[model samples]
Target: MPTVKPRLSKQHQRWVMPTLVALVSGILMGLTVAPVEAWFLAWIALAPLWVLVLFPTQRLKLLIPLVWGIGYHGVALAWITGVHPMMWMGVPWLASIAIALFCWIAITLWGAVLVTTWAVCMTVFSRGVGTFTRVLIGVALWCGLESLWSLGPLYWSSLSYTQSPHNLVILHLGQISGSLAVTGAIVAVNGLLAEAWIRYQGSGIGNRGLGKSYKAAMRLFASSCLLFVALHLVGFGLYSRPLVQPPQAALKVGIIQGNIPNTIKLYPEGLRRAIAGYTEGYITLADRGVDAVLTPEGALPFMWSEALRTPLYSAVQQKGVTAWIGAFGEQGQSYTNSMFTLTGDGEFSRYDKVKLVPIGEYIPFEQILGGLIHRLSPLEAKQVPGSPDQVFDTPFGRAIAAICYSSAFPEQLRYQANQGGQFILSAANNAHYNPSMPAQHHAQDTMRAIESDRWAVRATNTGYSGIVDPHGKTLWISGLNTYELHAETIYRRTTQTLYVRWGDWLTPLLLGLAVVFKLTSIQASQK
Candidate 1:
């Protein structure tokens, strides 16, 4: 006898199409970001999502966006899984896998929560509004949420980054109001598309005469296309404007990519290898007559006092070239992830990392979850955060330092630049994760470079060491997992971009506009 397959319940059946549509939209949005980098898709990626949120038939409107966020973040952050196999960190194999999976899922859900929040706001604000008001509210809410998220712990996945390192025109908008302006433009275009499509569906085009709705839909679609072109044209004008560099000696900076394995980087054997490798690279670059040499974050993999005993210390003294090295620094009973600037004359300054990774550097709710799983850090003690006002005074010039995860925060770098930091020095250790992680990290650095209108010199363990010009172009970059040394000429410019002066001004303006529109809509309904 043949058995009948179990069917989904009526309630569950109602979710099938909406979930599929939301997922497709989310996946498209994810592809527009790094790794896949199908940036052209970003303009239309949100149309399906907008349609679902703008015209909801189901009672659970938030679920659509939550699922969409899961799909989007799941694809964008798939690289988080590369942290698995923490057996190197003394975690059991199965437990290590569970930890990695937990991190990925937890972060994804958190990101999804943000998306759902936006959906909730959009639904409330756009009710009883015309297409134009809907578009404005959509852009406002997106930019506002992105700005708010920047204030939170994690901020790697901003909408503006979708155009980075690929679409130079759109990226140029960052100079005006930082990445928020670019984000606004992106959401504006996507919102218009969604509005056009919604209007088209309601137009009933099969009628003999094209009704007002059909004409309105066509006009809206055309207006969106025009607005998209106009945004690009304005961006092109910004990109075309020449960035005049101050007349100063070009600093020849040498970058050392020490290919250290994360598993043994803290071990005695791995520590020895790191010392030898960086010492060799430092000496080689010094012999080449570089102004300074840079090593990846945690290149020494030990405390500052311990690093003093390594050959790298003696090498820096003998070589006489200024060196910016990443290592652990001790303060009282706490340790900090810091970047040390050592000049040939023995002058040294330290900038402790301001932003620490949530679970990787310090555990949240440590009182509750402390014993459950180990933090991803190699150090036993909790790492302390540095003052946000810290900037490195190097022999070359005042420089902004972004240590590892701190690179994702643009406002910190902008503040440093505003405080007379002429250039950016980003040191990272991407040895633990896959190539995608470093690439995404590199993209973020490029965005910061463009926004600040400063040259950025980046050094990383294992690969992607490079220099980016003020225009967000990669002047030099290295291959993944390769031990390489490169030197490039980067300028120290004192000219501050508009973004450096204003600092995310557009975010608040957009949010305020959203509030005004919502209030107006409610007032109109009452009348």
Candidate 2:
């Protein structure tokens, strides 16, 4: 019989094992997004990792969180490594993996300091305080940390808000508080469970204060659960009720998914293919009696201005449906990412893309980057910024469009919606990464619809082309990689939502409350 591999000594397993586990898990997570795994939601699954760190000797306790953090970061940001090669050269996938693992390990070590502080404070405070106060304070701290993360370079895409396979009801809260609010709840639960495990483990009803801790925790959790239900139920109820009636009646829209490979998208033949694909898609929609058909960003390979005026517009005019495709136009001084709209009657209107992709679209500080910028990226000319965020006029209605990552920022979309964007149109090319990314990244836009109380029309290249309603529900979807024309009827709203005016009000308020709470705690401790 073959001998079994000997178990590693405790000293070796202490650091290497945890880091390896984290690294492997992170890579595994990067492979796909299907069968959405709530990577860090459950108390049962995560508690042991904390215990491994907590129950260890004082010297090792420091390292415990370190290892845990490596795993957390690795798995969380694993997918980002897939696109690293596209952005930077001489940077191997291993380098990205190593960098991601180390960065996460370092961040977790820092985050562990805050979490340890909370654990200590909880132990101290829980001696006399009720679980209600502890949960509230813990929730606040978690929100504060998440807010700090939002300001940093590495955004936590896997925070509690992004927890996949979670109850749809929990996701509904995003409309009221944005993604951060759900994160706050998740972090608080994690802390609460951790404290409870330390204090009242294995104790039934026999323990004296155990009953009190249980009651306080129950009340606090119940209150939070109720809040989530209220927000979700109210928002979902609106969706189930009669559909919204926009200022204008329903506008027939045709969404074209031209599955262009990354390499060819920038090539001459690729541009030719893109133009042909869009023109053909628009023609199909026009034949179907639709009013307008949409195409993804950078739709036309070359200058479509002359084409829109001549043969393109003339062909589209008779089809009875307008064509809204992303293309470029020259305004004498600079180039713009403009949307070319040819009405059925051949009336044309142009709208430039407002929010540019930071590095890909326009290098922020051109003077600073200098000639090295050209060397850094192979693109001939980094796209210049568009002058103004404009509205596209059509016989159907006024619609505003965001090019790509711009939609991820809800405030921008809300502004456009408020600026007479009866419907929000977002165009993106997700062909840059593996297919799953565009699907998930596009999912984030559903909140834009809910928060703004307007219908969102999301059209993307290579995947996740669909329509979302004001309540953040998917009405229709055309999954990635198919030669087909997809369409959806989404009702837009005339009246705007509360989130449109204020824009992420809960996050700032929560952050302010955290500051105040921390200040008060410091003062009380000093006293």
Candidate 3:
């Protein structure tokens, strides 16, 4: 006898299509960044979600966008799974899988909340508004949310990155309003498209309803087109012109990638090997006449005391060139993820890492999770955070060093730049993450270069070590999992852009304007 498939209930059928739309929207969002680098997809990526939100249907509107969030964040941040196998060493396979799933779900849900909230706001606050006003409100909501979150640690993939490594013209908009300006412009265009689609579908040519909708939609679309064109034209102008005079001189920076395995580098013998590997790389670069030599985070593999006794210290002092090496520095009972800078005079200036990775650097609620954390990992003492506004007086210029995860917060580097920082130095240990994370991370630094109008020196262990100019151009880039030494001429600038001076004040201002427009629309409808 043939078996019959179970039939879905009417309720299930109602939800299935919207769920698929959400998931598709999420996947489109992920494709906007690296590993695929289809940046243009971001322009229309939100249209599907807009279709779901703008049309009145029996399906839950908020729920659909939540699903979209899960799809988007899940794909974009899949690199978090790389830490799971390492967890397997201490926990059972099932437990490791559970841990990974928990993290993945938690982060995905957090990002999903942004999408869900935006949909709800549009559904409620967009009443009695034309397409232009509605689209402007949408832009405000997105920019406001982005500005609020960018001040903290969870500011990855702000949608502005969708233009990077491809759309340099649009990317230049970052110099004026920072990344949020670019984000607002993209969302406005998306909003106009969504409005036009809904209007065209519900009405016909030459009909009164169709004529009104067409005029409203076209007006909004024309306004959006004009704003986008103006922004790009200004961006092109800014890209061609240097906002600040070039630095009095340049730093012939040498960035070294030892390509040491994370597992091996953590062991005692691995520590010795890491030092040997880095020392050899340094000798090669120094011989080539670099003004300064840079190493990735944890290049020393030993505590500051032990590293001082080693040949790395003597070599830097003897070579008579400035050096920045990543290592651990202890003070009393705590140690920091530190960047140690040695001048030719043998004097050292230390800049400790302030923004620690959530679970990897320090477990939150340590009083409770400390035992479980210790059992599952090799960390002994929680890493100490360094003081903010700590600038290093390097021979190159007044440089600010952002270690590993600190680059996630734009404010951290911005503060340093405001305090006379000329160039930004980012040193990272990206060995534990997948390829996608490194590409995204590098894109963030490029935003920093544009926002602050400063050249960037990125030194990473295992890959993506390169130099970025003030115009957000990649001067020199490296491949992943390779042992290579690359050098580039980097300049330091003291000029600050509008974004660097005013920060993200535009977001709240836009939000206020949106609120006013909505209220005006409401009052006009009442009249």
Candidate 4:
């Protein structure tokens, strides 16, 4: 005999298809997000998972979905690994790697849990339901889970963002119901494909039923294709509507990108560079007759008190134009990551950053893990969070201020928009990670701009400073790791998009309908 090969056991054989489907689906979904931007893949990325749900043979359904979650989040959030080699934080080489890996793994697992929960709900609650009912349940479950996760400690990489800044038509759907509406459309299309796949497979079974089943499957496939086009049509209609501009002077805002390395951002040399770079950019923009200027988050990298004594502060005072500069603000005994505005009239106002990063900003479960790791954040002290209901009142207009991580939360920004925020000022420091993080962060800002129907001005450290119009169009964008200054005229509109007024209303409605559908299906089965 040439060779003796062992065949896979029945149990292993059963798991083979599910495992492959789960991984393929997850990875494709991940690639649909930013940096890769294979948005077209998202339409069919979830179809395999839905098919697996409709015809599950694996003993552990949750295991497959959990693996799917891991695959998706691992790829989408791979930028989190860029935090490694944090020797600049005084962490030992191996310890720094360990911390970065820990953060990446922990968050990936958490995100995976959401996917697993949705899969389990669909498998359990959608049994014996018709194809249409099952799809309704699937869409509801997915949107509901997205909404729930958004309210939690970490929220990024929503399904809605898959279309952002690329598929302007689908992205426009966000104006109606935030990201949930876009997500619902995506899930609905995937579910229809899965239903068609199931019917096609059934067509191969009995000879007598073959033609009818095949025709039905073909009809469903065509219907799905039509529905996809119809959704795009609706989105285009929404996108075509012109935004009502307020009858006021356009505010010309300048953004300064100080390309400072995160490793040395706190060092004496780094601080000197920060001051010089921003001061130079600020003065240049001021000379250009810009109404206001915005600096990236932590552009000063020092306390507000210390910043006031710096040359940058002196430059802003002399320029006599409002400057929104990012620095640390004092709060009782702790400090706050804040955006401080130096008004033209020499008055000062500050908007402290809420939604601090869990371990990176402040160690969570400090009573347990405090002593285990020396420090993950480069900051010398733990920072206090600001109130969520804050807005920046500037000479130009009242603007929503989202400092770095806060940009990921849509409802938070929507509430600020409802509170009379005319535009969005997004300040970020992306020096810690690679260009992917900045790109993703910029995408989030774009979504916020569309949902609130407000122009968004983004200033970032070490790259991707730009301006976006109300319709998710980038007016101007800077290159990564560049020291640049850009000024663009953006309007301040008082009209709020429907999303701003409703604020995630679709999520609750979907969840409630899912419950009713599930109960009705169960009752019908019993009868």
Compute each candidate's TM-score over C-alphas: 0.95, 0.74, 0.92, 0.96
lDDT of 2 by residue, 345-371 (tens): 564777776666443456546787444
RMSD, one per candidate, in order: 2.5, 6.1, 3.1, 2.0
lDDT of each: 0.86, 0.58, 0.79, 0.86
How much is 276 displaced in model 4, in angstroms?
1.1
For candidate 4, the per-residue lDDT at 320 reads 92
Q: 1 or 2, which is superior by lDDT? A: 1
Model 3 accuracy (lDDT, Cα): 0.79
Candidate 3 displacement at residue 33 in angstroms: 1.0
The number of residue pairs in model 1 that clash at the backbone is 0
Which pairs of residues collide in candidate 3?
Answer: none
- lDDT string, candidate 1, 92-119, tens digits: 8998898889889988998898889999
Per-prediction backbone clash count: 0, 2, 0, 0
Better of 3 and 4 by TM-score: 4
Please tell me which model should have the higher TM-score, number 1 or number 2: 1
